[model samples]
Target: MSDESAENLIAVGVHVIVKKHNFSKVYKVSENGTLMLGKNQKVEMHEVVGKPFWSTFEMIPKRGPSKNTYSLRLVERTESLNDLSGLKGQLSGQDNRLIVDYGTSQGLSKDEILRLQEAGKSGKEIIGSLIENSTSFAAKTEYSQEKYIRKKERKYMRFLTVCRPTIVSLHEMYFRQYHEKIGGLRMDALAQILCYSDVQADGLHLLYDSGCQGLPAAAMLNRIGENTSGHLINLHPGNVPQTAIVQAMNFPQELRDRHVAVNIYSFLRLHYQGESSMLDNISTSSKKVTDHIVERSVEKLNGETKSDEVSRTDTDISELETDAGENSTLFLRDAEKDADTLKRKLHEFEEAEEAVPVKKPKWFLETQRALDLLNSSKVRGLTVIAKEHPLNIVNALLPFLGASRPFVIFHTYREPLQETFMELKQKRNAINMRLFTNFLRSYQVLPDRTHPDILMSDTGGYILTGYLVQE
Candidate 1:
């Protein structure tokens, strides 16, 4: 393979899409591993290595010598979908009055279907055979026939398409299978959070997120851009912030460093008590070590110079005692000046000693960095997406945001945001507050059959957006 081809080829540890039945999922390609789709459904992932993104492969079932045992082999780097466009040319009845529902509509039995699968018939061929064997397929309406074909395709087809993972694609996968994991945050809702909060490059944003798996923080970081100096301080309830989705983003180390994940407890504790309160112990110990070193150096310098000064002072005293006149008074004044100069020089020497740099822990450094921004009220925006009461979290973190900066709160329930909205209004801490939800409906576009999808999410959760006002 050429160098260019190797660069484009899929490698381990990078996220890739595993698509089946028009639904897609994001999975990191691992070496010599298998991807589990469900309890009994999985695909051997080794074949996807070195395959280019967006390439498609067919899964062929090879029968074992033992009864009822088989393994799948992926072959044919061809692109295809479960398209019923060929059936588009076929006639359709106006209604399904003539159609009858029966379990025996498909003429192929389980054993025959297994045999056909073992014969290495491709997914498309198997779907076509199933469609041909269905006695009632022709009698169904166009929409019904299309639905039937899709249903059969899902069961028989094993086409895997590898796609380059994106933020939006991964968000959709989380929303579908693990909605609660992301705190029921929808893609549209997340987009609104970004827009309302005005997340952009070179902006300092603060976020308190839990149950979202770090998706909100990741989205903000992506918007902040990789090459900019924007920073995100993510506060989570857990001891360690959730970073699964963030890792999936595959952000560069420089961009990842811009994000500071800290525990909410520690952050709030430091914030309320001041930095000095927490660092006092560390500082006291550090100061003790530094003072001990400085004191020893000063004592050694004094011992070397003080003995000679004392001997000179004794000899001068003996000579001055014999004189007892203006010369002695003059000598006393000179001695006072010399003593002052020595004290000044000793202080200077102590100040000149190079102190060893104290290396702080990573968490302490990150927390302190975030604290500096918060204490200065430099955060341009604040977003709260938590499973807990948004009221308490928002009330505690809202003051850290700069004046006129935007703030958004997301919750799975409307009541929490409503309550928060009322409280913010009562306190007059925010203006232009709007509590609303989004209704998203997907569509299935086809010739003379374009309509809203029969199934849709009723609500994408609620969001309360407003701008903070200085008190």
Candidate 2:
């Protein structure tokens, strides 16, 4: 491959677009891995690893491990049907009167097709053979013949295109199949949110994403670019933020670090009050949930072997590190051992050694850093895309946004944004507030047959956008 082609090679572990016909999906390319496309059909990832994006590959039937079974191997397609227009020359009737609905239109049987597959017949070759054997081939019109060939090709002519995953491709995939997972957020709506919020490189932005599989954050990060001063605080409602799309984007570690995913509860408390306030809440929650917790006490025997002592020591260190954030004090586990024993030892150790440093939890440290950023008042914009009511969330986060900056709120339903519009208007908290929805229609432009697609989504959800002002 040339240097240009090498630049577009599909790398392993990054998401790749697998497309066939009108349906498309995203899959992580892995070494020596295969993806199942249809019943008894599969495509190997190794075939596309060094291939450029949008390269088409044909699935060739191969012999499986068991006798008389066939599998598929993806091979780079070197041939193209550039003269498909010539197919019109061989037609007779103008409509489907000549075409029969019987299953025996083609001469080949299932066993013969399997035999052809086992005989190493390419998809194109097999499709050609089927066309040759079809009794209705020359009886139908050119359009009918083309439609018949296409329908057959989709089934017998197994081919797929390898595409590089992008925001548009990934979002389309999610919107088509997993609409509920992304809060029914359409691409146009997401684009509007980014544009309305003015998410660009080299500024601090805030996102309160209650859901959408991290798509809102990923879009903002993509716009923010790499090696820039831009930073984003992605505040999610859950303890573990859903960042599948973010990871799928395969961004560099530097760009990924610029995005801080913190829990909304911890961030707000830490920013407005202090770390102690969040810690107190955490401690209370942990206490309430510790009732069914079983505490395992590790005891070292006097006659323990050297290997056993080393293993137990490692276990102790791991547990201590894991539990350090929950209970700040280091405990002498050898002398004291019980569930409540940990609590008692923690109190005694804290009383005796007040100068000792305690390790903060990972979430706590992240919340601290985000809190610092919030306190600096550098956040230029705020975006809220949530499954819950956006009113309360917008009200809580609007105060942190910089004056005269933009904020965009997105909800699947318009009524919630309508209520938010009313609430913000009453409070006089924002100006230029616009609550609106988007309609996205796709078109299929072909030679002499251009028209809009047969089906389209009636609503792409609603967005409420505005500029914030200091009271």
Please give the clash total of every predicted structure, in order: 0, 0
lDDT minimum window of 10 residues, candidate 1: 65-74
Model 1 residue pairs with clashes = none
Give the per-residue lDDT digits (tens) of candidate 2, residues 275-339. Answer: 67666666556544443242323223222333444555566677867775444332334434453
Score candidate 2 by lDDT: 0.77
TM-score for all models, in order of appearance: 0.74, 0.80
The whole-model lDDT of each prediction reads 0.78, 0.77
Candidate 1 residues 1-471, lDDT tens each? 898787578898887878776577768888877766655565677878887877777665545554332234445554244354464347667899977787889999999988887787766677778878877877778788877777766777677777776779888888887877887788888999999998989868999988787799889988998789798999989877898888877787899988999888778888788766767655667667866775676566556455645665566567756765665466566656665676677667545643544456577777888888666657998998878888989988887888999999888899988899989989987899999999988899978879999866778899999999876
Give candidate 1 misplaced runs (Cα > 4 Å): 1-8, 62-95, 98-102, 274-362, 373-377
